[model samples]
Target chain A: MSWYEQYRSRYARLKQAGKPFFPYAVFKDMVVVSLILAALCWLAYFAGAGLEDLADPTDSTYNPRPEWYFLFLFQALKFFPGRLEPVAAVVVPGVSVLLLLLVPLLDRGPLRHPLDRPFWTGLGLASLAAFGHLTWSGYHSPLINPTVEKDPLISRGIRLYREMRCAYCHKINKKGGNIGPELDRSAGSGSEEWLAKHLRDPQSVTPNSAMPKLNLLDDEIQALVAYMKSLGEPFTAEAPKLFTQNCASCHRIGETGGEAGHDLSLIGSARDKAFIKRYIGDPSKTNPDSSMPGFKGQLTEVQIEDLSRYLAGLGR
Target chain B: MIAWVHERTGLDRVWKALFERHVPEARGPAAWLYTLGSASLFVFLVQALTGALLAMSYAPTPDHAYDSVRYITGQVALGGFIRGLHHWGASFMVVLAVLHMLRVYFMGAYKYPREITWMTGVCLLLLVMGFSFTGDLLPWDQKAYWATAVGTNIAGQTPVIGGVVSRVLKGGSEMGAATLTRFYAFHVLVLPALLAMVVLVHLFLVVWHGISELPERRLQDGDPQGP
Candidate 1:
């Protein structure tokens, strides 16, 4: 008899000597499924799924992440840039599925044990390893364009800024009217206290200032100050190269550079330009435990401004 | 009553064939590993039940989808709980399905008479992923909208059929009301039907072939002796 026939006979003998499926197998299945059901209920009750804001098609800064199972594919797409994205997006997954479908046909040996089937076993383990590594990398990778709206106070400040129509008087990002000083340039220079004071009573801070005290509430003044502080000056191309030279040795941005410090890709969401600038000037002033060296006297004021602006614009 | 029903309907024979059949013994850890497939089926059933409950309160249109989901989450009794079950059930299904597939692959259980079972199982796995993709858009939240946008754009990156697939998925050049309705239909109507059919075939093949006995070290390197 052929090996296939021998195997079939052997399997038939094994089946004849085997246990009945109903009580033996069914009992185990019930036990495990009951455990799973209990766990599902526990998770459903405590860790309910979340929903974000309503779909905002106009919000260009929103960063999207796929479900966790697809994160490996999402991360894989980053490696193949430009026209080759199709390879990562389509051909890779298609070929994987095709290979998966063809596995039984390709490995037609009678060896059923993993040790006996080295090649297939090794391939399976390697695929599993790759999947795990890609998912880990994807989970750690920074958001593509982290929106400031992730911060509730900052988002509230944004709404207040829009509602107050501050753009009517001050130019921001060179888009608003030129009736007042450009907010991006002027705003970053003021401390939070100074900005709040100015928002409350402009004449008290600057006697000849044309800005009027709009009779705002304390919370409104705080929000406007926060909005003003968030406005950052535009930086030159030299800013990134400066970051590469000065900070990349100790800091990381996205998938590139070093990792000695906290990742700065989402730093802008946490810290405004003024705070970043102060920290950069003297790390000890803002963070007493910081091991980073001060760069106040080392870099020129213009270069520092450019660098801080570039960093502040990150993830926003 | 049982005999009367069995006499007319012949249900006893079917029950004997399905439940009273013999299965090759698997002891120790191997026995536990055998439960993954059944566990996956259990999770799928959970998903179907919870998904149906969610559908009762959900609206598929772009205009009402977000509000309806919000209302369900915030106001409806046990709505959040059911939605959570469905949400976690999707992840559990993916995890269990993958684990089951991996178990089958490692055990070389797909060889010989079980190839069709493995093939049907792969189709079921793909159907589960389709369910996830389509169900994601039902909430109409920012995460859902933008993720779907990126997902469709990626689909549109296929070499030749890219544009067509993307357009069909979106139901237009852009993701809008049409896309939401299309995804809702697939999530609720099409993918579930496909999943149920594929799952039936896989389970049928399993029963028809019988579960492959755990390969023994004695048979690791040599051919089995003929009966």
Candidate 2:
């Protein structure tokens, strides 16, 4: 007999013996299943949704968060740094899936009831809880934006500077280290014209300046200039000298400094106190060419004042 | 119909002859465990039809992908619902496939000749995952781009061949238009072709080996198998 005939006869015998068969029993279930399937098909047919625009490679500003289902995985990626990222992203999730796939093999007992298999039931529940928790944690990431905003001019500028992460490359007073320059000391003696000129166009005065021309509006420039002018010797004397020494390896002033940055010879001629202060507060805002980092929160207001004074002093 | 079957005397007669000759002596109850394989097949059919419909409107280019998806969601008739069904169906297929594997495993169905069946099943599962990964990048949204980026980066960490694997998958150092094209090809062509082949082999193995009998005691006692 052909396989289909044999199968059909076997099914007939089973039906004759009062046992369920494929079409008789399975087909009933399939009716309900078919209805559900039809509903889904209808939904999809009527939804009228499609995809988005072509992806841009150069756009780093795109905040590509995962779908809600994958939020936990996205969140998990943040904890991993450098080489460990792969382990967190791939290995952990892969192993979890593998374990899930092996669930049948792992629980090979005859007991079908939950009460009969307490350990297995408990393990399942615990796993569910853990997954839920990890997913929640991932969805609400705290580290994505660590710095909180601060208010008032000095505090706000200082807060904004730190929140913006400025001090990484720039120096302030004799304290903040230099990826950029000594702003505290330079501003004290620096000319308003020189500071304004530097603020407008750093490359004009020094061809190899690490500082870029900050394209600030007139008002922002004035505010920053005022803040930098307030950083002279009369303001605060306790600026950390260690920061200057440590940072000077990559920074310079006038004719004698490091090769990593440009000469601040005409900084006083380039910009006013407020302009310099804002530049120090957020270098990227003003100049796209600036290697000099901002000093928003890394230093206190007193320290910023001292650094601004130090930079203002450069032209003298 | 019976007279027609008897008179055809071609492939139908051959099939009828085989069916009559190979009849088994005994038949048992139709167990729920038997439904799993059929359920998985049902899901695959659903995916195929829905995916084909989706393909009619989808644009594979990076620039147009996101906008096209948006248009489908916002402008097309019932487009969002269809996409949702496709999305949920994919999830359901994964769940059902896994459950089916588990059922087979618990029943000790992977012994002897069934090992090849089990191996093919594994490959099928992997193909489903491949489908998921490739389908995900087609949307070309923020979520799709970054998830794929991270996924490709993970692929890049595979030791000696990591960089090559990542480059091949992504088409470059970063996820871009090339990556989208590569994923689209895999999703629509490569995966479906492989799945169809594996499914055929799986069915052939099932027919050749015959349905596995329940344990002797369970068969005689006629009690349902343990959940």
Candidate 3:
């Protein structure tokens, strides 16, 4: 008899002597399904899913990360830059999937034991290891935009700013009414104590000021101060010259400059002013492997702020 | 009454075939490993239930989607819990599906008569990912917006048909109202039907071929010795 025929007959005999599926296999399935559902319920109750702010396409500083399972693919795409990015994005995954679909045909041997099919077994383990490593790397990668929404104080302050109709009187980023000074220009430059005092009683700092007393609690005052402080002051035109003098050697913005480092033309899209400021002060603090030297001591604080504000406004 | 129904429909015979049919015993850890497929099925059911509940409260539009999600999470009774289940269930489904595939692969259970089963399973895995990708856009939050934007842009990287593929996914040149409504239809209407059909085929094949008996190390050759 042919080996296929022999194998089929042997399998038939094995089934003939096997136990019924109803009580045995079904029981095991029930136990597992129950356990999984219980755990899922626990997670759903204790750790509910969170929602971020409304979708704002104009908020280019928002960093985009895929769900965790897809992170490995996202990380894998980083290896291929520019033109070849499509290969990592498409071709490699396409080939791997095609190969997976053809696995039965590829390893047609009748050996059912993994030990007997050492090559296939090893290949499976290697794939799993690669997947695990890629996922770990993706998880550990530094986020270009450390989320502004993560800070409750800033979020609350923003909410309060809207509730108090601060925009009705004070201009900010050139959007609010022109009755009061632009907060982006002057409000952020004040010391924490001064800003807090101003929020609590507006006329104290600037005599004959038209602003009214907000009558906010201390915590509310603190929150507004933090929010204002987080805003970037306007950068000087000299900011572009500073970049050309120092950053253009390695970084590329728009059409000109070297490409030793990443293209910073769209840097504003993923990173906000605060992040750029910190990253400029000390690259190692945020990204240890960064080859760029820190400009903390080399440049003055005002220069760094100006540079960050300049970079932060780029792409947006 | 049960007997009369059984006689009229041959229900007992069908039940016996489906539930009482014999399976070759899988020993110890292998027996536990067999539960992964059923576990995945359970998670799928959870997703379906929670997804349906979410749909009741959800408005699939750019203007209302985010607000609707917030309402469901904050106001609707037990809404947060249900949404949480759906969110976590997606991850659970992916993990369980991969683990089950690994079990089948390592056991060489996809051989011969079960090759069709394996192929259908691959389709189901891809379908699960489809479900995830489509379901993500339903929230219409910042993460949903930016992630989907990046994801479609990646699809646009395909060699020749890339632009067309991404446009179809986004439902236009840009991600907007059309994208949200398109994703909603796929997530709620299209993928579930495809997944259900594929799953039925997979289950049918599993029963038809009989779960391949645990491979014996000693029977490396085509030997017919009983364990």
Every candidate's CA RMSD: 7.4, 13.5, 4.9
Per-candidate TM equals 0.75, 0.53, 0.81
Kindly report the fnat of each predicted structure, to 2 decimals: 0.74, 0.22, 0.77
Q: Which model scores highest in DockQ?
A: 3
Residue lDDT tens for model 1, A130-228: 999999999999987634535555556766666678788887656577777888767877889988888889999988898888999998887777767
Ranking by lDDT: 3, 1, 2
What TM-score does chain A of each model score against the native chain A? 0.55, 0.37, 0.64
Give lDDT tens digits, candidate 3, residues B146-210: 99999999999999999999999999999999999999999999999999999999999998988
Better of 1 and 2 by DockQ: 1
Question: In candidate 2, how many Å is residue A80 off?
Answer: 7.2
Runs with alpha carbons beyond 4 Å of true place in candidate 3? A145-150, A156-316, B218-227
DockQ of each: 0.63, 0.18, 0.69
Flag regions of model 1 displaced more than 4 Å: A146-316, B218-221, B225-227
Give the candidate number with the greatest lDDT.
3
Per-residue CA lDDT of model 2 for A39-126, tens digit only, reads 6676556643334334534334345655555566676766888878878767887787676556555665333444445676677668
Candidate 1 displacement at residue B159 in angstroms: 0.3
lDDT of 1 at A176: 71
Clashes in model 3: which pairs?
none
Q: Quantify all predictions' global Cα lDDT against the true fold.
A: 0.86, 0.63, 0.88
Q: Write the per-residue lDDT of candidate 2 for residues B4-88, one digit (tens) a residue.
A: 7668757665553333323222334435555577778888888898788878888999757776776777777766776778877
